[model samples]
Target: MMLFCDISLAARIERAETRLIADSSDASRARRGDTLGFALPYAGGVASFAEPDSPLNKVAGLGFEGVPSPADVDRVERAYAACGAPIQVELSTLADPAVGDLLTGRGYRLVSFENVLGRTLDGFQGEPPPPGVQVRRSGDEEFGPWVDLVVDAFGHADNQGVPSHEDFPRAVVENAIRDMAATGAWRLLALRDGAFAGGASMRVTDGIAQLTGAATAPEHRRRGVQSALLSARLAAAASAGCDLAVVTTQPGSKSQQNAHRQGFSLLYTRAVLVRTA
Candidate 1:
């Protein structure tokens, strides 16, 4: 019975993921900036290129509803090639099983598997932030610090191995924040003693909200910063009429454990497949 329930929830999560990527792509295209994203007719997925080196450029939402044919694979390659970027696809095991064989036959290699977890928001409750800690929505002027904190927390690195907080261009962060906000997403920042400690973002679609971009300063680890942020986001999502909240994380990682403690359950696992230009 539990297995059956898991399978049913996985299907729901897969549908949610497809919608998530499509909505995100639409938002990116609407911005009409350096980033270019669109729905791929052949692959039944969304393709996006945020930057020549940024990892956000890739294809997703594939194989959720149906399998991609050999011609679909060819079209994907052509689409990315036209943009001069390497081809990458994120596929869920819950998607068409043939998707794996098709991509592998086409020279795509497995990259990583990310676990999708979710929880219902109805009657959800969150604890208040610890004393001396405050959480709030970030403003435009706070983008720099928010980005800095996120980079520091995640240790983000670019293609050339340049550290994000020190070497990444500030304009990129500004544009990303602006694009997120323009796409109906909210960026949250956590502060301790008036100093930036952590940040996260949430986007809602069809009563579902996805929590992403979560990060915390190294010094702030285990200080309840993430818990506070999670609670705040869930409350905000509920207020926005969202009935479900989803997040992705490395399996068995602290993030996953945290989500579980908050009543989230595993939905499905997805692997990223890549083919270099």
Candidate 2:
């Protein structure tokens, strides 16, 4: 009997380890005031802050109006400073290029790129988990683990050079949980053989169900836990009247592997462009 298992699994462990250390380092920096809070409510949408005194403001929405002003920036900064978060900024193709130029002028570094991948839920192939494993809707009791898994899956699983998992603070996690519960924005799918081996969360917005927080435990390699959880979410989404499901995955990661196996395809690749503040 060897002290280890599959080589494929060993590679994953190394990736996860690298991811964890990088994430923690980023989080420490964010906690020390290197990043900014970009989630500020405005008329019809949200404006992102790139820095404490950035000239450019980011306004994004599925569908909304109005742009950020200096006054708006001041308001958002004050709120973020009080909340102990960095100012964050966001921009989309729909957003005016002027905003980007403004941020560029102000020396705000842009980062954290991701692809907004989507596919029709119709004819998505897969079956639910095997017997002995269960998927549960989450509540307060399950929030901690859910958040932790999300942090692990994305914030600490890849070699991606992004911020740390610690950037997700109590307020951020709490708000996410509340939103998931209130709008049915998310469904937490837990796979367990009497206990959790892996899980994933799905969120639906405007007929699009987005997948996040898909993870398998260290002890449960190749046990088909993640696949089952994914299948369950797809079935649930189709039943819930979703027209399509979207997911973002790191290039060549295990989740991407699973996605291809389960019938998801690429939509677009978004690069995270960052400049240190």
Candidate 3:
């Protein structure tokens, strides 16, 4: 039996690819005055930076190796200053450890932690759905509610910094939705009873489909809305020529339990380290 884990992994990667493709063109750099640029992460150790001084910062083809040393840190800081964007690096747990320490030593604060988890789907069996709910894909008209569910689910009253002056959460989500629409990279699905209950976004890249912006409405708890959404998304990925799907979450949270229910297992645990440089 081809392990379900293989399928799970492939779907996750494809979803990520879809995001990269969807956001590549409009990956705006941090604003000229804000000293920040948009950083859209991708696989293959490839990620991009954007800002007013993007050209000088060498936004094109900046490859992440192991943890960045002081010199590398200087290079990034210089890039940020030149671009008029304050320096903030969203380093993956997989980011070079040396770089993490260097930034921490410089006083960069840790803002958030994320975990990227995966599992095989070869022999996977989905859980039963709650009563009166059904799964369906979303389009432009339904996109707004989907975005709302994500913000609400994440419990963000508003994104406090950066994006408000720069390209913040709203901008990021809007840009993503636009890109997904343009390239058909997004697979938005809703679980509801003639109303919005829960939703998810699935995009593919490099044979891996990355899942993002999944959430249930505050009023729709414990009714299998998420489970249905997950099962539907995995099936969609398989039919859409994907090899696997990867979902990232904060480790040891309710979200992890949700992933487990959907047949996703631990692929790896990534840690986020930060400092004020």
Candidate 4:
């Protein structure tokens, strides 16, 4: 059965994503120093600065809890400016029109859009992936390898799709993956013909299974590695008591296509608005 996604569902996913940003703050602080890793409360969400060029650098879950106060908005802008980073706000389209109006009035330009896809975990039994592809949780000794493979997979852009607004260096992606693991994400690996072919990760927040990220190495692409990894995560999530599983993908990208094939639905779209510093 398809799950009905109302504004309430969006709020839950947004809040869960924002909290992951807080975890990124902790991971950044551990990787760098106390001077960095700031997750400031803004409006009803958080303005997180895990690192200057971090994918986690953004204001999320805003305006859902409440309107963005002028004082809070000013403070968030100043904080990002101090860090020498652009202020990116991931605003749900379901948000009040006033929120977008306020952001545009402050000179934030729409940079891109990402779709939030989801499926309810009601006795979902994922189908077996294509032959030669196997999925399993990465053991502690395998975590380092997991990061390496996933980041490498991330580096090879999809041949076609709406491009991502931001791309970080390999080192930056590695750090972010480490930070995500520090925040309690379970690393999962996909093996093709008994070799390390790809990796992915997930974190459960408030009974919502947040599919943090997943990538298949270039050599292993088009072999159903990603789909297999996703199925493994869904099964694990359902077993862990999660009611909903969500993944954010570039609009019309291969990832979104794979998700759609695996029974996920488009729940909402997050408009990426930016104020460059």
lDDT of 1 at 25: 54
lDDT of 3 by residue, 199-269 (tens): 77776666566675477777876777777888877777766676566786665656667777676666644
Better of 2 and 4 by lDDT: 4
Order the candidates by TM-score, highest first: 4, 1, 3, 2
- lDDT order, best first, reads 4, 1, 3, 2
Predicted model with the maximum TM-score? 4
Please tell me which predicted candidate would have the highest lDDT against the true structure: 4
- After superposition, candidate 4 runs with Cα above 4 Å error: none
Encode model 4's per-residue lDDT on 88-155: one tens digit a residue.
Answer: 99999877778999999999999999999999998889899789999999999988788889888889
lDDT for 92 in candidate 4 is 94
Candidate 1 Cα deviation (angstroms), residue 237: 1.2
For each candidate, the alpha-carbon lDDT, in order, equals 0.71, 0.52, 0.53, 0.89
Please give each candidate's TM-score.
0.82, 0.61, 0.66, 0.97
lDDT of 2 by residue, 6-26 (tens): 333222222222232223333
Backbone clashes for every candidate come to: 0, 14, 52, 0
What's the distance in Å from true for residue 126, model 3?
4.0
- Which residue pairs of candidate 4 clash? none
- Per-residue error for 262 in candidate 4, Å, reads 0.9
Higher-TM-score candidate of 1 and 4: 4
Error of 2 at 24 (Å): 23
Error in Å for residue 93 of model 2: 4.9
Candidate 3's displacement at residue 97, Å, is 4.6
Error of 3 at 108 (Å): 4.6
